[model samples]
Target chain A: MKSILLATTTFREAVRDRVFGLVAAFGLLLVLSTVIISPLTVGARGKIVTDIGLASISLFSLLMVLFVGSGMVHKEIDRRTIMTILSKPISRLDYLLGKYLGLWATLFVMMAAMTLIFACACALTEAEWKPTYLVALGMALCEMTVVTAVVVFFSSFTTPVLTSLFTLATFIVGHAIGDLERFAMVTGSAGMERAADISRFVLPNLDLFNVRNAVVHDLPVHSEHVVWAVVYALLYSAVLLAISDLLFRRREFK
Target chain B: MMTVLELRSVSKSYRSDFLFRRMPALTDVTFDVAAGETFAYLGHNGAGKTTTIKSLLGLIRVDAGNIRVFGHAPGTMAAKRRLGYLPENPYFYDHLTAREFLHLAARLNDMNRSDAKHRADQLLALVKMDHKANVRLRNFSKGMLQRVGLAQALIGDPELLVLDEPMGGLDPVGRYEVRRILEELKSRGKTLFMSSHILADVETLADRAAILNGGTLRRLVDLHELGHQERIMDLKFTQLSEAMVGELVRRGYPVERRAEAHHVLVEEHFAMAGLIDELVRSGSRLLRAAPHRVSLEEIFLREVERDVGQTPEDLLHRTVDELVGATSVKEESTP
Candidate 1:
């Protein structure tokens, strides 16, 4: 119940933020620009539009998480607002979970708005409306859940600038973990292989959620694969949140 | 009769890595606030007043010792449920309207929707913020923000309030309103643990006050006792001879001479009857005699001054030297 209140408040605050408004406006413009830019693709105009639209939504969501989500805890601590909230009967774990869930709520709104704009652009174009588009978007949202957790995890102990850099690096490395593992298999170096193995285990495989290419290119994406990706994202996010809670628990807000 | 808050030998130090220096913010600080009492945690800046308050609220962990709120460890939810804390320079979500903020606070305390709204409304009215309830806090003045902060602190209907500089950033009227609110809370049997440099407000509101200096507990005073003027007596005399004045001065009474009146300040423990007889014998006409009690401000200053006799510059230099020495020792032992 407390988490819901906190999440509602966070969502309200985020939606009212001028920065969120600006980012959402920019995202819509970029998504709509796909229509104008699709004619220049020379071929596969519909595919290009769908691909760009999906990628634009993903990119904007990442930007939102990186810029706004990373500051969730840092802003509270900097402004000393956490003192009042935490002084209540709320536990630190509840506070952290509330903040994480709040950012996710905010992301959900941003995604819904951007997805609406993307869908409209897709409808206006010659692209076929595939139910797979929603699946791809659902996966994108799941990927953002992981990104939000990563950003919030860094936010628990660091400044927003460092949190952003760290989360962005994590996001990049997370998406490339599969490639790193594959490279490790082909490489003859033992040390490189061990490092790759560690990276694959430690980092979230964000690539598991990247079904935009399959959906865009009209390729098959199994429902079982989607379910596994959802489970993986949730479990990874839970681990990150737990670590964040531990770090936040030990932190002194001096 | 019940202790609402207690701290025993609580200590905390902030360590800076740049110099390897650990600056102790609180040391052996101990005090308690009783139920239905207004206890003022009095100190100047850097006197560990805020540190102690934060320690009580579990915002910062003490390096040593224990703090209990209502007999439960301060970090426990059971204790927090009974306590409300207003931090120094209270900040809120600027995007949230005052009503929204209060509602959120109410809900966080587990109030149902209707109850939360009703309580929020009551608090807003109590704080005289109902008119601006829909206004975002970013538009609030410091005084307004303080009032709203107090309102939220009270929204939980907490049994105890831990306020750090509650009257800070308030105008005279705002301060008076807050004082009234505190007095009302006291009338209803709410315990208050507040830290403030405003000794006048502390004097007006505190039942007991604990003074801290140099990160140590200097003294804890019962205002009821200190409020009694009988401790010190002021005697006024007319037509007092210089010889009598000299004699009184020699006898250790604080004598002050005006153009036509001589005043002798006497401690209650001294023989006032003998002094009066001496004054009559000296053919001096007695004008008036009255008792004067010390103010909280005077006592606070005296306590701080007594802790460090030298000038502030000298004290600062000594502190720096000690920190450097401590840091050097720490670095040497690190290996």
Candidate 2:
């Protein structure tokens, strides 16, 4: 109950933030930018429109998660508002989870808005209403969930500036984990190979959520892969949230 | 009466970058607030008052000790349900109006929707914030914010209200309004554990106060005792001559001769009978005698200076300088 109250409050505050307004505005502009840019494609205007629209949504969502989510906890601490909230009946874990869910809800709203605009753009461009676009968007949302968790985790203990930097680094590294493994196999150095192997397990495999190419090229993505992606995103997010809760629990607000 | 809150031998230390040199924020601090009593925790800056409050609220874990709120460990849901806290320099969600903020606090305490709304209204009225209830907190003045903060603290109808500098950042009228609200809370039998540097407010509101200095409990003052204990006695007499004054001064009384009367400052334990006898024998007419106790401010300064190894005059000077600096900064930001 307390968590719900906190989450509601967090969502309200986040939506009211000027950064959210700016992000939404920029996201819409990016979606519409595809309208102007797609006609320049020589053959596949529909493909170009859907592809850019999905990528635009993914990129803007990641930007929102990285910049806005990074400050969710740090701002509370900096402004000393966390003291009042935590002093209530709510536990630190509840507060952390509430913030995560609240930001996630905001991300959901952003995704829905951008997807609607993207679908409209596709229809205007006479693009086929493929189920693959929705799948790609769903996976994109999952990717954002993972990234938001990473942002919250870093925001729990570090400054917003450092959290933004660290979360961005994590997102890049998470996506590259598969390539890192391949690179490690090609390298002859034992230490490099061992380090790469360890990172593959430690860092999240964000590549699982990247079904954009399959969707854009009209290739079939297996339901099993989608299930695994969902499971991995949920599990990875839970671990990050647990670590955030631990750090937040031990934190002393001076 | 029940003990609403207790802190037993609580100590906390913060580690700096310097190796093996921990800064002690609180050391062996122990005190308790009885049910329905207004307990003031007094200290200067860095005197561990805030640290103790945070420890009791479980915002920070103690290095060694125990804290119980309503006989349960603090930070537990059961205890927190009965606790409402107003932090110093409170920063609320600026996007929220006063009513929404209070409702949020009420719901977090598990109040039903209708009850939360009712209580928020009641508290807003109690703090005289009903007029601004619909305004966003970002547009509020400091005093308005403090009032709304107080309203939120009272939203749950908490049995214990832990306020850290509740009157901070308020003007004189705002402070008076806050004190009146606290007085009302006291009348309703709410236990108040307040930490404040405002000695006048403490003297006016607190039943008992504990002074902390240098991370240690310096003195616990029972204001009730001041009504019975005489600290200083003022004696007035007429027809006081220079020779009589000399005699009185020689007899160890601090006598200041006025044109119409002679004023004698007597120690609390001085022999009043002997002094009167002397006055009568000297044919000086007695005017009046009165006893006075030292003010809370005086005692606070004495304790703070004693802890810092400075004279009261020096401390007062430094305090004035600091206040001036603070005022200038505030002025710079006023526009």
Candidate 3:
């Protein structure tokens, strides 16, 4: 029960963080700007809007995960507040899970709000409001799950700066994972091959969850793909949070 | 009485960045805090006071030994349900109003919507922050933050209260209010285990205290024994003759003659009437007489200084031996 209250508190705290407000405003503006620029893209107005809208969700949501998630534990420790909270009957896992869910909730709200505006702009252009917006939103959520996991994992042992860098690096590699593998094969470098393989496994293939293209082109969406991506996200996030919980369990706040 | 909390042979160390080195923070420390007792865990800066509190709260795991709160492991759900904690230099979500934060805590403690609201109101009033309940925590002073933290800790009405430097940022009035609140809780039979550098506050509030140094429990100062019932008197009289001073000395009063007065030290067992009667009978004018009581700070500092190298268990063993000896003496006399 306390865990539930704690999760709510965590959500509120993350929501009010200055970074959240900044990203929300930025996303709102970026998605809104897509309306003015959509017609300039000639025959690709729908694609442009979808691209801008998806990019806004991806970028702003990642910002929230990286900035807010990395600082969750460190801020508590630095302010000596962890002592007060942890000294209660709450377990480390409860604290970690509560925080993860809290940030996820904030991301959900922010993404949903931005998607509404994105949809409105697309609808204004005689582009039908396809049900595929749900697909894009789902994929966006999956993207954040992986990003939040990476943030939580790095936050356990490293400083916020390092965690941000590592998470951002993972985001980049997760996107270009296919290219890295193909490059490794062509170069015939065993070390590079191993590095690429490890990167592919370690970094989530965010592109797999990139359903924006499917949404834009009006392609038939795969329910199996959604299930696989969701399962992958859940498994990946659980691993990251598990490692985070392990790290937090051993942290001595003095 | 059930032990509200206990740490058995607990040892904790931090791994150093410099390879293979572990800095021991607490070493084989063992103690039990009885239900409703205000046990003070004391130490200087860098002492294991915070470390011990952290371990008991399960903020950090001990390398060896075990700790139980309410008969359950420290980090377990059941154990946490009965606990409330106040950290030193508390920081809350600055954007949230005080009420919001406490409401959040109450909700987490599993209170229903209406119940959480009521508890939040009650706690804020208890902490004397009812007026500031709706104010954002960002604008609060340090004392306000500490008070809010106190309110938050009590959100669940925890059976076991753990306070880490609760008085750190409080002003004199705030400290007094906190002390009053603690006294109220103590009277209601709630256990409080706290660590603080504020020796005077600890002396005034704590029943028994354990001192920590260099990540070790050095000694537990028994407040009752160290508190003497004797009152020493500092006397000043105008032009007191030698005969009057001699009369005081004859009545078994230790007298030290200063520039124009005499100092009389009174032991607890010494009846004051005989000396007062004798002084009046001798016709010596009593200009001034003031009683001085033994302070807990002095005893705390003395024991802390004297037991510098002793482990926490060593001090506990010594106290146990003294108790055994005293009990046996009572038993022998009874026969």
Candidate 4:
């Protein structure tokens, strides 16, 4: 119950940032840019518009995770407000979960707004809504769930500059899980392969959540795939949050 | 009396730099706040006053000590539920209005919406913030924030209220208002463990106080005891002859012979009666006799400047013994 309260307040607070609004506006501009796509070839035009719109929604949400989500914990500590909140009957775990859920709410709103814009863009560009868009958008929120957890995890221990750097690095590595494996094999080093192997078990395969191509081509995305992706998102986010709670639990607010 | 808050051998150390050298923030601090008493935690800057309060509320873990609130370990849910806390230079969720913030605090205390709203209304009015209920906290002045902060601390109406520098940023009016609210809380049988460098307000509200110096417990002063301590009688009288004046000065009273009236400073109340009798017998007209009480400010300064090199164990035992003695004194003195 307390976690939900923290989440609501956090959502309200994050939404007040101008960076959040402008990022959404920029994503809209990117989505609406697809409206001017050449319509002579409907199949090619649909694929192009779908590709651009889904990516725009994904980009917008990631940006929200990057700028706004990274500061949730730090802001409270910097302002010394966490002293009162934690001094109350709330546990550190509850506080961390509230922060994660709060960012999720903000991302959900941003994704919803971007998806609505993408839908209009899809309609305008003759790239009619396939049920796949929801799957693709759902997967996008899922991917950001893991990424938001990453932001939250980093924000738990470090400054914003270091958090942003580490989160951006993690985002790159998460998406390149395939490349990491290939490089692990191509390089004949045993230690590199072992490290890659460990990361494979630890880092979320964010690549799996990218059904945008299948989504853009109007291909059928199996329900089992979405379910597994969600399972992965939930489990990965849990691990990150657990580790975050461990770090934050020991933190002394000096 | 029930012990509402207890800290035994509490110490905290911080990492100073990349070198990771440890600097003690609180060293062997020991004190207990009894239920229904306003216990002032006094110190100069860097004297670990906030560190001690944080340890009490479990905001920070102490390195080598134990703290309990209402018999529960510090920062436990059981502990937290029984107490409210306001930190130094309080900055709440500025994004929330005064009303919304109060509601949030109430809900966090596990109140349902309707109850939270009802309680928030009472608190808003109690803090005299009803007119600005909808006004955002970011728009509030420092004093306004302190007022609302106090009201928020009262939201749960917990058994104990731990406040850090509650009157630090307030104007005189704000200070008086907060002091009055704290006095009311005390009258209602609430335990208040407040930390402050501001001595004047502590003098008015605290029943007993513990002073810290360089992160060490230097003195635990029963203001009742401290108030009576070193109390002097300033006696004004007509000058006596040289022989009588020599007798008075030789007897250890400080006699200042002014042009119109002479003054004799009697060091103790027991000494005053005899000195006055002697002056009357010696053909001196007594003009006035006023009692001067030593303030907490003076004691606080002396405490911080005094080098207390006792070990943590010694400080702990001394605190417990002094507490027992003070309790007996209080019991004996109370009508």
Candidate 5:
């Protein structure tokens, strides 16, 4: 119940920030630019429009999470705002979960708004409307779910600058884990393969959400894959949130 | 009276950034605030007052000892639900308006929507911020922000209020307003545990106070008893002959000459009788004989200065111990 209030507060704050507005407006322009740039590509104009539009959505949403979410918890601690809230009946878990949900809500809004602009750009560029575009955007939102959780995890225990770097590294490592495992397998390097094996349990498989290529190219993606990918995102986020709670519970907000 | 807040030999230490050396923030601090009393937690900068407040509020884990609010552990929801905290120089969400911030705080405390709004409205008016309820906190002045901070702290209307430096960083008018609001809260039987360097305000509002110095509890002062213990008297005289002045000095009273007035310091009330008899025999004109009471500032400074007068060896040993991370067992302070 408190988490919803916190979520609305977080969403309101993000909406009120001029930076959020500026970035959002810029994101809209970037998505619509697919119209101007779709003619530049030699191949299918519709495919180019879809690719650029989807990439814009992914990039802008990740940027918002990195820039804003990294500072979410730490800002409260630094400013001593959490002092009053925590001094109330709110548990550390509730506070953490509230902050987590709040940040995710903000991410959800950013993704939704970008998706809306992407859809409009699709119509403006005469690109065929397909459900895959929605799926591609939804997968990006899932990826953002992981990224949002990662930022909160790091921000719970560290500074904003470090949180951003660590979250970005987590995102990069999560996406490259698959290739890293393949490379280790091809070389038959026991140590590297072992590292990759352990990473599967530790790092998120963000590749599960990378359906932009298959989505834009009209490839087959089973409904089960989408369902399982969302499940994986939720489960992975829960693990990260639980660890974050443990760390946060023991924190001294001095 | 029921004990609303209790700290039993609480201690805390923070590790230094460079050497990871143990820097003690609080040591063997023990005090309890009774119901319907305003207890002042007094300390200078870096004197562990905030550490103690945070310990009581469960914002930080104390290295040793225990703290309870309403008989529940500090961090437990049972304890928290009974207390409200207003930190020094509270920095809330700048983007949030005064009403929005209070609404969130109310909801966090499990208040329903109608109750939250109603409480927000009441608290805003209580803090005299109803006129600026819609103003963003980022645009508020320091004193205005403090007013909002106080209102939010009272959102739950808890049984106890833990205010750290509530009067700090405020102008004279701001201080007056805050003190007035605190007085009203006190009138309603709310227990207040506050820390302030303003001794006048402490003396005005606090029923009792505990002074912390050098990470240790220095003294637990009862203001009522302190005021009663001051027995010195100041006797002012005019038109006293030089011989009378000489005789009075010989009789052991120090006379201070201020323009036309001769002031005599009477050490005790028993001595004042003899001095007055002598003055009457000498036909000295008595202007006024006023009782001299020691101010809290004087007491506070004396206590803090006593702690500052450590021997060179004690200082060197403490520094080395801090550098080497040595644990020294501390005992409870005697009042």
Candidate 6:
């Protein structure tokens, strides 16, 4: 019960911050830019909008997850508010979970708002709402799980600036997992292949949640595939959160 | 009797630099706060007061010994439920109103929705902050912020309150109000362990005070014993001639002649009663006579200074004995 309240409180506090406004602006501009870029494609207006929307959501969400989520614990400690929270009956794990849930909820709210705007634009322009929009949102939610996990992992025992840098690097590496593995196979270098193998397992394969190609090209998305991706996201989030909780439990409040 | 909190020879050391040797923050510091007692933990800056508080709260792990707060480990939730703590410099969510912040704290302490709201209201009102309950805490004055902090600490109606400098930044009026509230808590049979450098407030408010310096327990002043010092009798009369002074001196009284008046100091407190009666009977004019006791501030300063270079173990025991003796002195000197 306490952890839930803590999580809710964190969510409320984050919404009041300036980053939420900036992320919203970025989301809105991305959606408008898609509208302008749509006419430039031949026989692929739908594909163009889908590509732009997916990329825009990923970019903005990564920023929210990396920058905003990364600062959740740091700000609490920096402001000395953790002392007040921990002085109560709450445990360190509960506080950490609260922080994770709070930032995750904030990201959800931001993504939900941007998704609705993008959906509205797609509907008005095409004169029909695509069911793929819901699928895209579901994929976006799964992707957030991984993004939030990475942010949380970096946030543990690291500064906000450093965490942001590392999380962004992880995001880039996560997106290149397939390419790196393919490159390693082609290069036939044992060391590089071993590095690629380790990187694939260690980093989040954000590409798994990258459903733009399927949604834009009108390709079929299997139910089992979506389920598998959701499961991976959930497991990844739990692992990262567990690690974060461990690091945070030992951290002395300043 | 169950001790509300006990620190059994706890010690903590902090390394000065990443590569340097460790500096002891507390050395074999031990004390217990029983239920319903106000224990004043006093010390100057760099003293072990804050370290002790942190150890009790389990914020800093002790290098040696044990601490039992309410019969449970300090960091355990079971013990924490019965404890309310106010950090020295309390930090709260700036965007949250006083009421919201306290309510949030209450909820986190496992108070149900309605109970949390009612308790938050009662606490805010108790701190005289009900008027500003709706105002964002960031805009609050320091005193108001401290009051809100105090209210938050009291959310669970904690059995033991560990206040670290709760009165530090408050104005005189705020300090008095806080003292009054603490006394009221004491009346309710709650244990309070408060830390502060303001000796006067500690002297006035604490039932028993333990002083520390350089992470060592210098003294444990039982104010009850310290209060035993008697109010001395002082008599002022018109200046007496040398012969008159000599005559009065022969009466077994300590008489000193001043330029304008004569001071008659008596060791026997009731001597005032006898002298006053004799003076009236003899038709002698009585200028003024009054009783006074030395302030605790004087004793605290003197004792602390005297024990500056003493070992922690000896200092603790000596101060405890002196406190007992001081109280007996008060009881003896009262007439």
Question: What is the iRMSD of the candidate numbered 5?
Answer: 0.8
- The candidate maximizing lDDT is 1
- Which residue pairs come into collision in candidate 2? none
Give DockQ for candidates 1 onward, in order: 0.79, 0.77, 0.47, 0.64, 0.78, 0.47
List candidate 5 stretches off by more than 4 Å: A22-32, B230-257, B262-291, B310-335
* Candidate 2: tens digits of C-alpha lDDT, residues B180-234: 9899899999999999988889989999988888999988889877545436677
Provide the TM-score, chain A, model 3: 0.91
How good is model 5 by TM-score?
Answer: 0.88
By summed lDDT, the worst window of 10 consecutive residues in model 2 chain B runs over B325-334
lDDT of 3 by residue, B1-335 (tens): 89999899989888866797998988889889999899999877767777777777776788999899889977677888899988878897787899998887787677789998999999999999999989999999999999999999889989988998989899999999999998899899999998887877887888898877666677776777654543445454555567665655454444555556555555434666566666666666677767655455544454565546765434433333332232221122222
What tens-digit string does per-residue lDDT give for candidate 1 at A46-160? 7877777788788888988888887888888988899999998898988888888988998887888877777777678776778889999999999999999998899999999
TM-score of chain A of 2: 0.94
Clashing residue pair totals per candidate (backbone < 3 A): 0, 0, 3, 0, 0, 4
| Per-model lDDT | 0.83, 0.82, 0.77, 0.82, 0.83, 0.77
Candidate 4 C-alpha error for residue B97, in Å: 1.3
lDDT of 6 by residue, B1-335 (tens): 66898888888898789797899999998888888888998777777787788778877789899999888988889988998999887778877889999999999888898999999999999999999999988798878888998999899999999998989789999999999999888889888899987777777778888877778777777887774564445577763445545555555454544456666654345567877676545545568886534446545554566645765434433443343332221122224
lDDT of 2 by residue, A1-254 (tens): 67777778778887877546645675567556666776777878777777777778888898888877888888888888898888888899989988898889888988888887777777776667787789999999999999999988998998999999988888889899888878877887788788888877888788889999998887899999999999999999999899899998888987
> Residues B271-324, candidate 5, lDDT per residue (tens digit)?
688778778678788899887665666556656767567753344334323433
Chain A only, candidate 4, TM-score = 0.91
Q: Which candidate wins on DockQ?
A: 1
Give the better candidate number (1 or 3) by TM-score.
1
In candidate 6, the residue pairs with backbone N, CA or C atoms under 3 Å apart (3 or more residues apart, or in different chains) clash, namely B225-B327, B228-B330, B228-B331, B229-B330
Model 3 sits at a Cα RMSD from the real structure of 9.2
What are the runs in model 2 whose C-alpha is more than 4 Å off?
A: A19-24, A27-40, A126-129, B18-20, B227-230, B235-266, B269-289, B310-335
Worst 10 residues of 1 chain A by lDDT: A22-31
lDDT of 4: 0.82
Task: Please give, for residues B251-322, the per-residue lDDT of candidate 4 as tens digits.
Answer: 444556556676665656466787789779889899899874656776676667566575533332233334
